[model samples]
Target: MEVSMFGGLVLVMVLVVVVVPALLVGLVLWLVSRSTSDDGGAPARAARRHELLVSSVAVLAAVVCTVVLLAQPVAWPGWASAPGVLQAITPFSVALVLCVVRAVGEQTWPRPRGEVRSAPLARRTIWSLGGARLRIVLVTAAALAVALVVFGATADPTGRAFATNPVTLPDGSVVSGASGPYPGWPYGLPMLLGLALAVAATFVALGSITRRPPLHGVPARHDDAVRATSAARLLGAVQLCLGVGLGGALAVGGAAIQSRGQNLLLDELPTHGLVAVGGGVALLGIAVVVASGIAGLLAAWPRAARHAGAPAATGAPA
Candidate 1:
């Protein structure tokens, strides 16, 4: 049964890793070709081309990292019990790479020749570049990370075999409530580090987007629109990472708790509180996982460049 399950999971992973990226690359290529054919001015075409290139590079980097990680013959330390760590960290890694790519892309974006450039009157920061939605997503990710860390710290110290406390029943039998492996410190530590790195990368990327010279010869509003779109995508990636991480953490932790609760019930324990808590956590985790899918879509969805003089949207800076 376990082998069959593992095989099914591998198949699913292959489908996701291979199919999704192919679709995205195809979409990006279509956009690039479409942009090339458009009669837009040189500045507009240049902006579109640069944006599309960055998008393609970022997607490629993520796909490569994911394939390499998944293809490893052996699991990393602590991975046996916390398989969710891979699922969570994969997206985090993608987000981190995306940030780095965006930062570099912004810094190196083409500049108009023989044109005078001026800085914006106000200095821009990550907070200034992104809107309220971005901030909210960041906060949500932080909350989930904190929860994962706290739960991991409290996990039982048993290594390799089981992560939950063993329950002794009336029949002289010992049940380790949950089967081996839980998201203890071994898994949590890696996730925490990844989160920290992702945060730093996001900050740097947003800062670059804000500070980079405006697209040369483009209207200021168009440039602002471009920056805002970039920032949105970056934040969307961050949110997707955190959302997946949190969902995995909750699901694993909850399963452990639920197993313990079931054991207690079997042992005729006094109360069923743990069972309720575990179920709730698991359900919440599932919900989060679903929401993360939406976040991923938002991150990958292409935005058309806003033309000059268009009415300002809700998320764009004034």
Candidate 2:
């Protein structure tokens, strides 16, 4: 029954991560294509086409990476083995890579031939590109990562099963809920490294986006919108990844605590607090998972950046 339930959960996740986004992207692209087709301006049409092409490629690459990661067999040591590690890392890795690809693609935006091009005098920064939403997401992810590391470090080293407080019974036998799996250095180390790499990749991608030349033949507002959209997407991806990881960690830790409470010996100990604590943690984890799914959806939806009345570029020749 547990296996079946887990399988069902996996199916739901696959649908969320893969099928839903693909359909939405296809629908959006079709609508955009139709709208662009009816317009008769060459420059506008070209800009839209270039945007579509780059977006499609980036989405495709991210989806392909996700599939490969999910399907590949990996052997990881510790309680949270290959599946756990992959679950925690895949979202962030795929999203970060997608951002990088899109940033690189933006650099290649076509310029009009035999025409003078203008550059913006205002310098672009990561903060300017992403706005408040980006900062909030980044700070949240960083906090979660830190918490996970601290929890892992403090946990007793259990190999495969959850570490529980040892209990002594009147029968002169000592028992524990489980043994062998604790989020110790072994588990924490790899996750920390992966997160660090993800942060580095995110900065690199954002830097690329900020530094890329403005799109020519498009209105200044159009160029701002494009950059803002890209930043929003990156922020969404980052939020999704970290949120999922934090949720999973909470769920696992809660399960460990609940297992201890469920031990038959605990029934006679006159204390049932662990059960309540565990349940609360588990519920919070579930909530986080749901929120992460929403974040993923938001990331998939394209939108222009919401700048607070920033002046449009004057299109002065560089």
- In order of appearance, the predictions have TM-scores of 0.78, 0.79
Structural RMSD, model 1? 4.8
Summing lDDT over every window of 10 consecutive residues in candidate 1, give the lowest-scoring window: 2-11
Root-mean-square deviation of every model: 4.8, 4.1
Model 1, range 86-133, lDDT digits (tens) per residue?
544665676787788888888678755564544354556667667774
**Pairs clashing within candidate 1:** none
lDDT of each: 0.63, 0.61
Error of 2 at 195 (Å): 1.1
| Tens-digit lDDT string for candidate 2 (1-318) | 322333344335645745466567657775756764423246546666666677678777877777776654434345544334554466566767777787788678765444445556465678877778677677756766775776575566542245556668799888665522233455556566767777777778777767656566655555665666666666666666666556655665665566666663345653357677766876886687678667756655544423436676324223
Candidate maximizing lDDT: 1
- Candidate 2 regions off by >4 Å? 1-19, 36-42, 74-87, 112-123, 179-184, 264-266, 270-272, 304-310, 313-318
Residue pairs with clashing backbones, model 2: 158-180, 158-181, 159-180, 159-181, 160-180, 160-181
